[model samples]
Target: MKNDFEEKMADIMIGEAVTALLDEGVAIGWAVLTERLRLAIENETDENRVRAGLRAIEEVRREMHTRASERTGLPRVEDRSAHKLH
Candidate 1:
């Protein structure tokens, strides 16, 4: 029962909403990862354990960057803090 313009508008609105939700989810995920890395660094006493934790954190970060780049069709930016929502 909808006209072509109305259908197109609905699609556009849906796309925007989906993009917003994805962005928020990514922000929350990054915040959680950052907190975990901070805690690991702060509480760990052993150098090896701290190094391992840092490696794990870095791996997760790289994976997230790759996924985001693939999704957006844009190259990954070096300054992740600039993209932080907080």
Candidate 2:
């Protein structure tokens, strides 16, 4: 029973860590997309389309930051390099 409980708790913690990783990945993806969108806007000739793309990217970025903040319990990256896989 003791071993079983330990295994279960380990699984739970692993699940939480995985969730955090996925969440952080989403934020990273948003940052990458934001950079791309900025470049696209600059290259595009139409001002209205550029503005629309910028707005959409900003909204996605806002949500990503918010969710990452809540999940990590830190406004910025809580840890730059740290992960255990086994």
Candidate 3:
């Protein structure tokens, strides 16, 4: 169960990410959005909020890919970072 603060953070982060994705279209990739969300949450002091924000980011990205792929009848492209040696 998420606390109020964590839930609030997830809402804020997910809302912003969805807005950006919708405004910019599906060309935005996972790495770019993840980097933006990471920067947004970098200074957050609460670990729970930070974790929630990251999870929200992933949720938005996955949904974006699913929707876009469905609309375009194209396969979802995997994130480049997924193949990289991190």
Best candidate according to lDDT: 3
Q: Rate the local accuracy (lDDT) of all candidates.
A: 0.59, 0.56, 0.74
TM-score to native of every candidate shown: 0.49, 0.46, 0.50
Clashes of 1: 0
RMSD of each: 18.8, 18.7, 7.7
Q: Roughly what TM-score does model 2 have, to 2 decimal places? A: 0.46
Worst 10 residues of 3 by lDDT: 75-84
| RMSD from true fold, candidate 3 | 7.7
> Positional deviation of 39 in candidate 2, in angstroms?
1.3
lDDT per residue as tens, model 3, 1-86? 45666767777886786677778775566667776677777898987868987877776678788888889887667654566696
Q: Which candidate has the top score in TM-score?
A: 3
In candidate 2, stretches whose alpha carbon ends up further than 4 angstroms from where it belongs are 1-28, 74-86
Error of 1 at 68 (Å): 0.7
Candidate 2: C-alpha RMSD to true structure equals 18.7
> What is the full ranking by TM-score, best candidate first?
3, 1, 2
